[model samples]
Target: MTTQPHFFIEDSLLYAEEFFAGLGKITRFSGRTVTADDIKDADYLLTRSTTKVNEALLYKCTKLKFVGTATAGYNHIDADYLAERNIEWAPAAGCNADAVADYVISSGLNLANKYGFALKDKKIAIVGVGQIGKRLTKRFAALGCEVVQFDPVRAELESAFTSASFADVLACDFITCHVPYVKSGKHTTHHMFDKQTLLKLKPETILINACRGEVINNADLVEVLTAGHDLRVVLDVFENEPEIEMALLPLLEFGTPHIAGHSLEGKARGTEILYQILCQRLELPVEIKLQDLLPAMAVDHMVLTEKYQLSQRQFRALMNLVYDIRNDDVDFRLGLAKSPDSFDSLRRNYSIRRELTSLKIYCDDTLYPTFTNLGFNTSLIKGE
Candidate 1:
């Protein structure tokens, strides 16, 4: 009889229980609470970004041969340690690109609505034009917003891609960061937006950071806000997660517990990628499809009649019906004051959020192509 490989996975992963049940004997644990002893005899370990996969946690896992992180960011994993042990590792990059872009568009529209301004009238500066940044550029461009990007590495490779200077980024109406966390190097992103950078920003410039908390110094951010700078900040990731600075909560226009990329489709895609990687490492044939694992969307279809036209505000409201970012904002705001653990708990128990592609919308012919380009499934409806 073939021995069933024992697999250890983080409990927060969506579809993990069902996806891995047939492949091996599975054990799930809280990512942050997992210890070295937990995977002592496990053949494989899978985790999200929350778990720190280092020598300290894996020193006792003598049987471990493969590890996978179901997240785009892998700063938590020590690559050199894994290389020394000859442990094969994979990270699910670009899996959450669309989901994050959806979050940015939703929140951007919300901000525009709240402040009574047209989205097309404002310029957005996107820092680090990687997977997520590229998606944001496409979506915002479709919506007629002026977008400027800053990514030195990508600029070197793609001549067609325009690269804006850091000084130019600071002058924009809104700034969003999507760079990975790099502690040191020529492209070190650690606290890239320090006190000096923050001070240079134009007053009332909206700042959004969903990339990593460390990219912006939280202390500097708090100091800048306290100084009565008219900046509006939206943070999905914080410098210190779970144990976030509570003082910054009241000042934010919107805040979430790092769920910007935790959409149902995104989570499923991450799981599927890791599943494929594990299968390849184990010499097992891949059998699962991502579509097979997804649940039916709670919202299936929407109708836009001739009586109502698709204005920016109306479009935002319609998008909210599919995936409203404010719900997450409210949850974090209410829970953050209660306890530190609430942040992690909120993410672990995040509500089911579907991507825009999951819902079909019936609208006028003029609006169908635009909505389709924005990743919405759309059908033409007669307009009066």
Candidate 2:
């Protein structure tokens, strides 16, 4: 029997080494620190966005057969090179859709509170109508806001989908980006929100980017913010990993170390996606279930009365219990203050954050539809 193919997993994917124990000679390495030499003899590569699986890193890895990224975005992976080498690749796309949407919703609400604006009265634009963006469209529209989806690709591809023009999108009260980072394409998103675009926004526009960093030019953003442009920006991802543009920190309304999809379920779900794909390729039965792999939620059970119904304001308190963007912002700034490379360190030890689906809420049956539409896990109460 040929020695089981070597498996190199990122150490941050907690318990992944053990998860693949039976199938391979597993080695766990920090994603940022792993080099080509480390995977030279590896037959499989399992990694996160932090690890770039490009020719520069994988040229020495002769035995590599399959590469999987436990992330929704695949820009980090050089797909063109992978395809040329006949190496199969897979991304856990949309595995963290709910988690990322939660972050956006939370961030939006936080900004509304600080800016003294009502979300319902605002015209919001979702820049990409993909997984996370689609969920946001539903949630924001359900909350009575006008949502304009700006996805040129989807508009061209989907017969039923409609996209907003760049001019129309510029006039929205808020704009959030969820598109992938494409360097050279008609629909390229890298530095999509550069100085020219950033300056054109209507006054006091709330711009958000949880999708990717270079999607908005960091240096341009710092310069724009420095010039005191009437705009508020929130970022969960940065242009550079581990080391970000330090001057941009104080200018951000909210900044985090790319933890938008760091929810416990989200990360596990991504890994699970890769695991199942690998199992299929190897003709092995996947015995692991996602639910069994998760730990108990922090607030496992919540009771909702008529007073706790889902109003724009009431929902904030509820969401804050699960996540408060302000807290993450503070932590991000503090971490960077401690060390420039504190980004990966912060992500490696990210606190356990459970998705709304992880928490079960007991509520009257009448409100079941409302809660479910907002993506909560709920138990219906019978009328007595």
Candidate 1 residue lDDT tens string, 1-384: 999999899987778866777789999988878888887887889899789999999999988988899988888899999999999898998888888888988888999999999988889999999999988888888788899999987887998877998888998999999998889988889999988999999998989999899999999999999999889899999987878888888889999998899888998788888888877777888887887767777678887774354689887987787778888898888886677568888987888688987888888876776788677878887442
- What CA RMSD would you report for each candidate? 3.1, 2.8
In model 1, the runs with Cα more than 4 Å from the true position are 1-4, 60-63, 157-160, 280-286, 303-309, 362-366, 378-384
Tens-place lDDT per residue, model 2, 1-384, is 788888888876755754688778888887888888888887989898889889989999887899998888776899999999999999988989999889988988888777778889999999999999889888888677999989999999999988889888888989999988788879888898999999999888989999878899999999988998988899998898767899998888999988898888898888888888989999999987788767787578787774345666677777788888899889888888888788988976778587888877778866766667677887876451
| Per-candidate TM-score against the hidden true structure | 0.88, 0.88
Give each model's whole-structure lDDT. 0.87, 0.85
Residue range with the least summed lDDT across 10 consecutive positions in model 1: 302-311
Error of 1 at 210 (Å): 1.1
